[model samples]
Target: MSLSEVTARMAKAADQAGRSMDDLSLIAVSKVQPNERVASVLDEGHRIFGENKVQEAAAKWPMFRETYENIELHLIGPLQTNKARQAMHLAQAIHTVDRLKLATTIARLAQELGSCPDLFVQVNTGEEPQKSGILPTEADEFIAEVRELDLPLVGLMCIPPVDEEPSLHFALLAKIAARNGLQGLSMGMSGDFERAIALGATHIRVGSAIFGERDYG
Candidate 1:
């Protein structure tokens, strides 16, 4: 689907949900997509994008920013502590902060650099062992711990298990964020974004439908 179509759908979803389009951010997940494809979207005046890897974003966005303006980059994959500093510099927001160790590292980096990117604590709503998020049971304590570090925590993020219904997980994440006073819910993707918006997803990460399927080969 094209960018205009995606925005129109987002508008419809928000209207149906009684939410304003201003409250929603469309993060074009540009991981592994061709430069031409990404550039095409930029040419269409899309300013916000998401990248799965810090290095890929660093390599791509700087060149694009030279030509375009106000490009917002978000890191939406597992963040390595070793690369935390680089990720902070490259992206406007980081959406996979799941561990106290990593959060502590980011806290220290924020002190050293005198600035930090907006952070979203990733929650493993499905309790999937292989997933990179703090368990639901541990979310409250973790959010408190992150707050103590003053890491610019802005919201929460989750990826529902692909085999199950997504609205349940989105609702779960929204519940957690609501109790904690977090306004940002970074959920949803190409498939279930409309459902996510209905459940208060402030940011929807759409990839394949926006840039076409990624060529990982």
Candidate 2:
């Protein structure tokens, strides 16, 4: 689909949810996309883009940085400890902070690097043991722990189970954010974003729907 179509769909979803289009931010998940494709989307007035892997983002961002200084880069995948320094420099927000070690790494790096981006705590809403997130039962304690850090704990992020409806998952994340005074909900992707918006998703990460399926061969 074209960028215009994606924007229209986003606006329509916001309208359906009784939210102004201005209130929501569309984060184009440009994980495996080329820099040219990112530039094309930037031409469409999309300033926020999400990348899922540190290596891919590291390889791609330099090509656009000089030209797209105002664009916001977000890291939306599990981050490794070694990548924290580079991620802090490039990312405007990190959406997959699930462990204290990684958080401490980011905080220490942010202090040394002289920059700290917005931070969102990722919760394992589906309680999938394989996923990279804090467990639901431990979320409150985690939030309290992170509050003392210098990073801005802006909200929570979660990926629902792939096969099930996401409303419950989205609602749970929203509730957690509310209980903790966080203001953003970074839930939902292309397949279930409309439901997520209805359930109070302030930020939606969309990739396939906007850029088409990724060719991973």
Candidate 3:
């Protein structure tokens, strides 16, 4: 699908959910995509994009920033502690702040640099051991811990098990964010974003749907 189609669909979903267009952010996931495809999207006046790796973002976005104004980058994948500074410099938001160790690293870096990106706690609503998120039961305490570090904890994020229904996870994430008084819910992707918006997703990460299928080769 093209950018306009996605935007129109998102608008319809938000309108149906009683949310204003201003309340939503569309993060075009540009991971593994060619710079030509990414540039095409940029030419369409899209400023907000997402990258899955700090290395990829560091490699790709500087040239784009030289050309585009107000480009907003988001880190939507796992972040290593050592790369926290680079990720902070590259992205406006970090959606995978999953553990205390990484959180502490970010806090220390913020102290030294005197700045930090907006952060979202990633919650493993499905309790998948292989996934990089705090367990649902541990999310509240983790949020508190992040707050103690004085980090900019703007919201929560989750990626549901691919085989399972996404709305359940989205709703669970929304519930967690609500009790913690966080308004940003970074849940949803190409397939179930409408359902996610219905359950309170403030940020939708649409990858191939916006950039076309990625050629990993």
Candidate 4:
């Protein structure tokens, strides 16, 4: 799908969900995609992008940051403790914070640098042990821990098990956010975003549908 088609789909989904198109932000996941593909999306007026790895983002951000002043880079994957500074430097939002140690690292770095970006707690809605997220049962405590830090705790994020229906996971995340007084749900992706919108996803990360299959070597 092209960028226009992607936006149109988002518009349709938002409309069906009784939300204005402007109410949702489409974060184009750019992980593993080349800089040229990212530039193409940027040229099409998509200012917000999501990257899964700090190393990939670090390697790609400088290539475009100087040209796209309004670009908003979001880290949408597992963040390592040692990479907190690099993530803070390149990301406007970090979406995979699942533990206090990682949060503390980010908080410390943000304080030292005099900059704190938006932060989101990742929940393992599917209870997948292999995934990098706090267990759903531990979400409140995790949020409470991170809240004490001086970062802007904007919301919750999750990636459902690929085999199961995603709506359940999205709804669960939305409920968790509501219970915690968080208004953002960074759920959904290229495959199930429309359903996520219907279930109250405030942000959807889309990639393949817009940029085609990514070649990650």
CA RMSD, predictions in order: 0.6, 1.3, 0.6, 1.0
Each model's lDDT: 0.95, 0.87, 0.95, 0.91
Question: After superposing candidate 4, which stretches have Cα over 4 Å from the reference?
Answer: none
lDDT (10s digit) by residue, model 2, range 1-217: 7767877887788888889877788899998876677788888777889999888988888778777768889999999999988898889999999999988888888788778899999999999988989998899999988887777789999999887778989989999999999989999898887888888888999998888888787
Poorly placed runs, candidate 3 (over 4 Å): none
Where in model 1 is the C-alpha error above 4 Å? Answer: none
Candidate 1 pairs with clashing backbones:
none
How far does residue 88 in candidate 4 sit from its true spot (Å)? 0.3
- List, residue by residue over 46-71, the lDDT tens digit for candidate 1: 99999999889889999999999899
Instruction: Answer with 1 or 4, whichever has the higher lDDT.
Output: 1
Kindly list the per-residue Cα lDDT of model 3 for residues 1-217, writing each as its tens digit.
9899999999999999998889999999999999999999999999999999999999999999999999999999999999999999888999999989999999999999899999999999999989999999999999999999999999999999999999989999999999999999999999999999999999999999998899988
Answer with 3 or 4, whichever has the higher lDDT.
Answer: 3
Residue 180 of model 1, lDDT score: 99
Residue 84 deviation, candidate 4, in Å?
0.1
> Stretches of candidate 2 above 4 Å error?
none
